[model samples]
Target: MIDRSQLQTVLESDFLERSFPVFNSPGIKDEDVMIHSLGCSVWNTLGHELGFMAVVEGPAPIASGNDIRSDSVWFDKADNTPLVLIEFERYDGTDRGYGKLEEKLGNLMEASMRWGDQPTLLVLSAWSPGLVSAPDFERLELMFRRGFSNSKGAKIPAPTNCQLLLHRLVLSESHTGLLQLQRMNFRWS
Candidate 1:
């Protein structure tokens, strides 16, 4: 089981305070640069929150039958055991579309399969204000409940022990200098 309160505490801390400034810096208009910078910020914040000493791009082929690559993987600071697998999806305000959301769901399913029965967290972090709406989130949640399938009808069952956390980062102009992080309650069972 996930310690929701602990995770909430970590998120509510000064993590965003230290992370979002990277975007406010000059010359961050490039989409790739913004994505990479946000990934790094998230990696650092997860390390601090989870006591992870190493956060690498991936432990590729996290499962035996598949070749999916996780965006980042966390390791324990002391023993170096895998702790979490993170997948990041960023949407520029212009492209608030469902295609990206479907792609992200596929990635999450792959990560969940790789995680198996481990206590590791599978984080699906989306940095888009448009993706944070209730209907959009519900649609994503439904995908998780239904599992993944190919166009030809082959199906992959969702992992039983894969605890998922959907972290949605909404950048609002109303909050002049703040990036709001909303944790959507997505049930895996």
Candidate 2:
């Protein structure tokens, strides 16, 4: 069973590390080709590393039977269960990022309700390089934790391993196509 910590590591090494300035690069103007190809490549790399099958814009694994396409979904090698569902949101502005984040949370929450009891990692990977400050991540985490109600009735009770990872991109002159991650990992109850 893969724990949240292990999931964090894989997300960092396999996905985040591979998808850099290209993924979250503020420098790039034309992103037509890079967005299409790199998105699939990073997830493919992640799926290969963890022995899972990854797809971009694939249908979500919610039991609701509604057609919901997630940013990324990872299935078990046997091609049965979806072990992970990720939603990527670009941190555009102060007011905009929150709405996008909340929308992404809804996607994860639906999947969490369906598969949170099992070993699943519902991730909201946001790209906020210099837009969002460091301390605001705490506020973001608390805001997200509220999405999962402690009592299970209206709001789905998040799994013990429910985590929100906010990616802060930091550019370094040494690496040409790189922006390092300053991550704030929060475990929601």
Candidate 3:
């Protein structure tokens, strides 16, 4: 089971305030900022706040293709067993965002095979206020439960050892600053 209190402490910490200033820095594209930088910041924060080693853009092989990429992977520094596999997106409530979620879920399923019986955290980090709305968040949760099918038209089993966390970055009105960091609980049954 996940320690909700510890998770809450990490989410409520100064990590976002300290790390998100990069988004406001001049010249970076707003659309690409989260994709390019947020993952690293979150990886570092999780390491500092929880003592886990987090790696960005880690390489992993997927069943469907050659080695696919992950936004970040978190694990114990000593043993190196994966504790989490994170995927980031800049969802604007569009079809593309939904498609991205589906693709990432598929990759996560393949990645979980390496962990054996240990549970791995499947985190989807994205923009907030957009996902804050109840209906939109619920829709994403539904898609998570109904994972993608394989080329054989057979449904791939969702990982029972996986726990999903939706980490939303709530930005300021200027769209260049972080207002808040929201952590919403999502799980696959």
Candidate 4:
């Protein structure tokens, strides 16, 4: 699997050049864009402030009974399409935690609506698994489908135009990380 530290470094650098603007609108002051440090929370480059609770910590599931924190970076499309919500799941677990994944997805859907008409793109990233099975992956895929449908059907506007993307990162035998991107889009009636 890819070294977690190396991946984290790349993400941090990418955020400043490509991901900081979505949350750092002109109306909001630079001080308002709180970024938490990598351990259990997100931080700005200076490592000074705590971001929105849900953005730093994954949304507390109304029912999942786990308030696990997630790593997310919010940014607007430079082309002005909408907001991009990126959630990174770099678990050291042998089996990827679908529960945490669902909770993060839930948070992204709720958070995106607050950004107005801007459509949201939720991306889930992860590392290679040591003990995950084909069945487990299948189950996670089905769960994601259900979550995507329900999130689209939320009381928000039907035409919010939200989309979902799964960015899978796997470490090969050569210790190089392979990137795979998959897309999912849904709209509620």
Best candidate according to TM-score = 3
* Worst ten in a row by lDDT for model 4: 180-189
Report clash pairs, candidate 2.
none
Clashes of 2: 0
Model 1 C-alpha lDDT per residue in residues 40-96, reported as the tens digit of each score: 566656666666654556654444455666667776666656566667766554445
Q: What shift in Å separates residue 140 of candidate 3 from its native position after superposition?
A: 3.8
C-alpha TM-score for every candidate: 0.69, 0.63, 0.72, 0.40
Encode model 4's per-residue lDDT on 102-176: one tens digit a residue: 555555554454445353445555433332322244444444445444433544232255555554433222123
Better candidate number, 2 or 3, judged by TM-score: 3
Q: What C-alpha lDDT does candidate 1 achieve relative to the native structure?
A: 0.58
Counted clashes in each candidate structure: 0, 0, 0, 5
lDDT tens readout by residue for model 2, 21-50: 454444433234543254445555666577
Q: Candidate 2's C-alpha lDDT?
A: 0.55
Off by over 4 Å in 1: 23-30, 62-66, 77-81, 92-96, 115-119, 129-135, 150-154, 173-189
lDDT, ranked from best to worst: 3, 1, 2, 4
Q: What is the lDDT of residue 38 in candidate 3?
A: 60
**Backbone steric clashes in candidate 3, count:** 0
Considering summed lDDT, which 10 consecutive residues are worst modelled in model 2?
A: 167-176
**When superposed on Cα atoms, how far off is each prediction in RMSD?**
4.5, 5.4, 4.1, 12.8
* Clashing residue pairs for model 4: 22-76, 35-43, 35-44, 36-42, 36-43
TM value for model 3: 0.72
